[model samples]
Every structure is written in structure tokens, then in C-alpha cells.
Target: MGEEMNKDVTIDTPYITLGQLLKEEAVVGTGGQAKWYLREHTVSVNSEPDDRRGRKLYDGDTVQVPEVGTFTIRSK
Candidate 1:
């Protein structure tokens, strides 16, 4: 990915779910689609592959979605 593909997502809560993050970033059309989306795509959390929709993402976590971009979670 290019420099433009790096994005920071801010959250107010302690953590955000993988599904919610995808929806917030417009990666998926709806929250329900996160499950299927994960199955079809490769998502790396902190350099490790993770496909759990309910995966809790906290501040400083890095998520990489091939073809989409890299997401860094930030606390607000």
C-alpha cells in the first residue's frame, strides 16, 4: 500500500470490534456483512492474521486489509 493508504481511526471507547471498525471505515456496507467480508478478505491485526468479527481493537492496534488500506486505531 501507498502512503495515502495509511489511515488513523479514532475511538472514544476502550476498544472497538473488528466488525464495527470495518463499518466505520466503510469497508463493509453493513455491520452484518463483516462476517462474510472477513471470510473473503485477509485482515491482519498487529501483523497477525485475524478473522474474528468480534475481535477487540484497542488504541495503537494496527489493522491491514489488502487492497483496502492500513488502519491504525487511535484513542480520542
Candidate 2:
């Protein structure tokens, strides 16, 4: 709804789905909720709103929003 706070999570891989990342990072309250957010919330890649939750998040891809916080794809 407002300016998204910067949040961080460590990813073990380069490619990950939004749904999986949500669960893995415990971002969404529930799996079903993640789906709903995917539809309602405007997820951004680098800065633009990205609706494709199924899109693979690779290196340097940043998912940001007011509720979900900021998730950066990292190497571990």
C-alpha cells in the first residue's frame, strides 16, 4: 500500500518460483494466501510490477512490495 520496506532472505539457488520462495522464506501467511497476493499485490522485478508469480527468480532479481518486503536472490 505504501513504500515497501527493504527485507532480505538468503536463497540457496539461482532459480526459484515466487510461491516456493514465499513458503521457503515464510513471507506469506499460507500457501493459499500467496496465490491471492500474487493476484492482488503488484510484485516488482528490479522496480517494475511483475504479475507472473510463476516467473523464475534468478540472480539479481528483486521482489519488492510494501507487505512482502524486499527479497533478493543470493548465492550460498
Candidate 3:
């Protein structure tokens, strides 16, 4: 195998789950509560609180933060 690469994706229609964003992503913390808190606290698109960790992201939405980089939805 080789070093894993995170692909750059854009939303044309929209996706409803954070898990759907990653190929092998996992929540890191003490437990579900902690994970929930992390999800609640962090995770933003275009400087907006992505309340639903399972929110369907739409085009023009930008996922940002200390990590996770930025995900911009492009025309497909």
C-alpha cells in the first residue's frame, strides 16, 4: 500500500452525513457524548454551525475549522 490521500470533493446535490465525507474517518474522544460535543462544537461550513452532523451539505457550502480542511461544492 501507499500513503493515503484525502480526495477533494464538491457537493452538487448534497450529502447528509459526515461519515459520507470520509473513506476511513473516525471520531476521536472519550465516548459518544464527547464525539457529539466535538461534532457540535467543531464542524462548520462557510462559518456556520453545521448543527446536523448528518446535514446534507449543499453546493457553495464550505467546511472549515482547525482541521478537516475545507470542502467546496463545485458544479458537476
User: 1-76, model 2: which lDDT tens digit per residue?
Assistant: 6665665556677688777777777767776777887788777778887766577887777888557478887766
| Candidate order (lDDT) | 1, 2, 3
lDDT of 1 at 39: 94
Stretches of candidate 1 exceeding 4 Å from the true structure: 1-4
- Name the lDDT value of residue 38 in candidate 1: 95
TM-score, cand. 1 vs. native? 0.92
lDDT of each: 0.94, 0.74, 0.50
The better-scoring model by TM-score among 1 and 3 is: 1
Task: List per-candidate RMSD values in Å.
Answer: 1.9, 2.7, 5.9
TM-score of each: 0.92, 0.72, 0.51
Model 3: residues with Cα > 4 Å off, grouped in runs: 1-8, 11-16, 23-41
Q: Which is the leading candidate under TM-score?
A: 1
Residue 73 shift from truth in candidate 2, angstroms? 0.9
> Model 3: per-residue lDDT, tens digit, 1-76?
4443334565555453443543223333333443465455576667876645455555555655334456564546
